[model samples]
Target: MSLNSVLPTRPIQRLSEALANQIAAGEVVERPVSVVKELLENALDSGATEILIAVEEGGEKSIQVTDNGKGIAADQMLLAVSRHATSKITCYQELSAVASLGFRGEALASISSVSRFELISRQDVSANAWRIKSDSGERWSALEPVAGKLGTRVKVDDLFFNTPARKKFLRAPRTEFNHIDELVRRAMLSRMEVAIQLVHNHKTVRQVEAAVTREAQIKRLGRLLGDDFVTQSMHVEFEAQDVKLEGWLALPTFNRSQNDMQYIFVNGRIVRDRLLFHALKQAYADVLYNGRHPAYVLFLSLPFEKVDVNVHPAKYEVRFADSRFVYDFIRRSVRDVVARPITQADAMRESPASVFERPDQHRQGKSVSTSFLAPHKPSPRESQAFFAFQQPVELPLSDVPSINEPLLQAYADGSDTRLASTSNAIPPLGFAKMQLHGVYILAENEQGLVLVDMHAAHERIVYERMKTQWQNQRLIAQPLLVPISLTLDLADMRAWETHQAWLEKLGFELEALGPQQLKVSAVPTLLAKADIAQLIKDVLADWRQHQDSERIESQINARLSTMACHGAVRAHRQLSLAEMNQLLRDMEQTPASSQCNHGRPTWVGLSMKQLDSLFMRGQ
Candidate 1:
């Protein structure tokens, strides 16, 4: 076949400007939220400190955004709606370093192409605002003088009216509004100093005041996420290698079934990164149960030149200059908060009284005990508040704080009697009163009754202890008396070839007998009794596709968790009050002690107010 025969006779023609814009709209304007995202980004880029968003019929009918930002100049009115025109950046150097959330310049053009669009603005220097109108972005009206405030207002109506096919795909009003609501949430969180209000059909849907202080910020978070999330989350601020991460991480006990509550902002721009998300997953791997996702609102800030934000049309994905370093930084930073030993100060912060705190009194208001301000050494009183008065340790449990037996004696209702005396401060876990059915530990704290699952708590304690004991040592490889053989395909063979050293480091010894067959001579001592063949197959199967250390560690932990289960104290086994209290003390000090390895809650609290409510005491 001749090359000329394969070619088309006619040359391809350039697309019309209107068609080009509509095509761009296909990417930039997925739904009502897409338009809201673009407009809000523009408003923020304009240095707006206050913004108002109004929508009609889930934005299918109309969307109007007004911002108190430095308005556009009268001369730039036409170019503002034109394709590939933006004042945020002027050259390739600026493109490489996109400080503003919207730099692609396609958003306004793509948006105007598919809707009735109007732009009104009056700069600080202008005596009056100028207005420009566009219908499907093809023709624009000449700028006309109009009375307006010293800011900008962008109104979009009849979205996708020029393209019925796109309009036909629009979702239900409430559904589309929900998407818009979520998009606004990111915008609100992106700028806490900016006042934001959203109205739907003339009724205010949401509003947030400008948050200028730590207290106001926590209240804003509570209003957005919920009082429970606010109360149960902790503040995290970590910086290394010129990258700073500050945000809130919910306790493992306060996890979600889906990632609905996860929000990550990069330099005030909301983005989704698989590598960052995977790092988070690794951080919460051992803490969360299968199928459960952790909820967090993290903000990562680095130099403007270190990240590329122009990779996606919608600007949702970003590429970091050093993805690996970023990954490790996120993983280590979150893990330090997620998996550290709980201190007495931590328990005091989550005190029973904190349970009754108003929604506005969120958890993040409390500072972390660190050198972020100054190194704080807990006084003897701080650590000893858990006890009324120490009794010499006569019990068999090591490192267990023995308290006067009478100090543990509580009222029949499981409320502390000594705390009422005001002579001794109550501990976080309080004192163990008795064992219930050898399965639950009944305790009394200053808060109220606390019921703990003994087995689950003990299991977590032993697992964490084992992890610490083994943390510094290389995995000891156990040689098999008889080697197990397996047959593999080319992909699995390639995975073995690529990650053979990692496998060996994790305590696996494999030899390739042939291209299609492999023999395993040894495995980790921890997994000596595990189904070696199946484990290897499962790990290698995943290794062929996923090339992260998480997969290997997950497999190891699964085996280790099973081992810890066997080592933990058994359910339905009788124990003395001292033994029960010892377990409680261990739990208070253990990392992720609130949940077992399987993610089941190890303990639960019942505030006196809650208990009273059950009996209608107030009424």
Candidate 2:
């Protein structure tokens, strides 16, 4: 009885070949996007001069790809649908030095297993062409030889026809189309020599003719990204042993809410590598704020053996033999390029105002204004009052509960309490009455004028207060009467799961409504008017774009910057005198009040002597 109880009841058995293939298909050809990527790679590998893509209803009904490449022979038509059949590579030794974008040769087989697949081809020298159709091998046929040009055309219709479960997992038409469009864009960036065209529902969505040079390619990318990006971009180039990195990076001033603008390619293959992205962050660390992604089109070329492209079925990710070396190389190269001063031509290309105008001509008629009046002499008693006001006053820590604990401790311990004590000191008797340059206040004995950058000052005050409330877990949430439902991508859903606790801390209360949907009950107090659905999508999109990195802190910083910018005071709005005075008072109490969160100076002080010199009164 004991021996029988210890033994297993049944032996394990292997899954059926069909079931196992389907599982592999799920990994390799997950959706229409997977099919599009594979077909495009094959076209490029075939040395296609011009490739065209046509889709219907986001490829739910059909996907057709045509390429002007050396087509297959009549005999190879049937074998093309068979697994492990590819002309790109043959031996196991070639696996280490794979040169083509695709080599596994499993895409056509997997796709045919799930969809209605048809292949039509004719070689350049052959007069007759062949066509073959297969539907999960259940029904197969050969069409009559048809006359066609020297190229290949593949049409996949009714994808997932044999697997309703996989079909059910498909997203909406628009969403799926966006994914396909992104795949096409990535491929286009990797291959600048081949002309590419994209059509959806008989309308041309995107088309790129073979560019004359790398510069022309970058200009084409500018057109796709937007004219503003082209104008703001700086060209970058660097070369190392058997490696080269070249592209254009947007100026520090140009940024995006999400990092969608970043593109990286390795060995002529578009890839999403974490090390490359991290190196980009490191290069721009001192220049950009958190959450703001720089725009760039970076292409890296290296020996094929140095990179492993088979890490992911999609082939969009790669592992490098010397990742750190690649990272440092890219970082230093980008930094060097950015640090170089922009030439006159570069400036003109980057800024519209610089175009068609000479700097000297623009400044010709502008004469410096030079007018200053002598400072009004004050009475002895007024001078004494000003002096007395400058004396530091002791502030009781208990009196200001708003003060952070670390700051209070610093003050109580009598360590560098000058700024703190001066902050608490009473304002001079005539402080409110003093005005210089119609904006700044000339304090009695302070070394500098209490100058303020109207927008930046307010931004700091608002940001600090909001950040404090956000950090203390005391967000005042506003519940929604009717909760909103959000549909997201798988990557975003994964991000939500990983950061659910952090989201809750930031005053977001969400629950899973479906496979890729979330139900939101409330939002952060500071973001009451924010579109919760859009915000969730944006956060998720950002998470997906930068999720490959090891540094979650970078993502957190980006979120914080987003929140700060959303809540900060915008420029050009006029403030009343009282509001301006209140802002100054608050700035006096804030640490690091001299700069904004992004490290740009918040205020610039001008002394009386400097102002007199500018007015020609110093003579």
Expressed as tens digits, the lDDT of each residue in 363-410 for candidate 1 is 333211110001112334333322111221121233535343345444
Candidate 1 wrong stretches, greater than 4 Å: 1-9, 345-396, 400-426, 469-474, 480-500, 511-520, 528-547, 608-619
Q: Write out the backbone clash pairs for model 2.
A: 290-558, 291-558, 370-615, 371-615
The superposed Cα distance between candidate 1 and the true structure at residue 118, in angstroms, equals: 0.9
Prediction 2 global C-alpha lDDT: 0.65
Number of the predicted model whose lDDT against the real structure is largest? 1
Q: Across residues 143-187, which tens digit of lDDT does each residue of candidate 2 receive?
A: 659877789999999989889999999999889999999888877
Q: Rate the local accuracy (lDDT) of all candidates.
A: 0.78, 0.65
Residue 243's lDDT in candidate 1: 100
TM-score of 1: 0.84
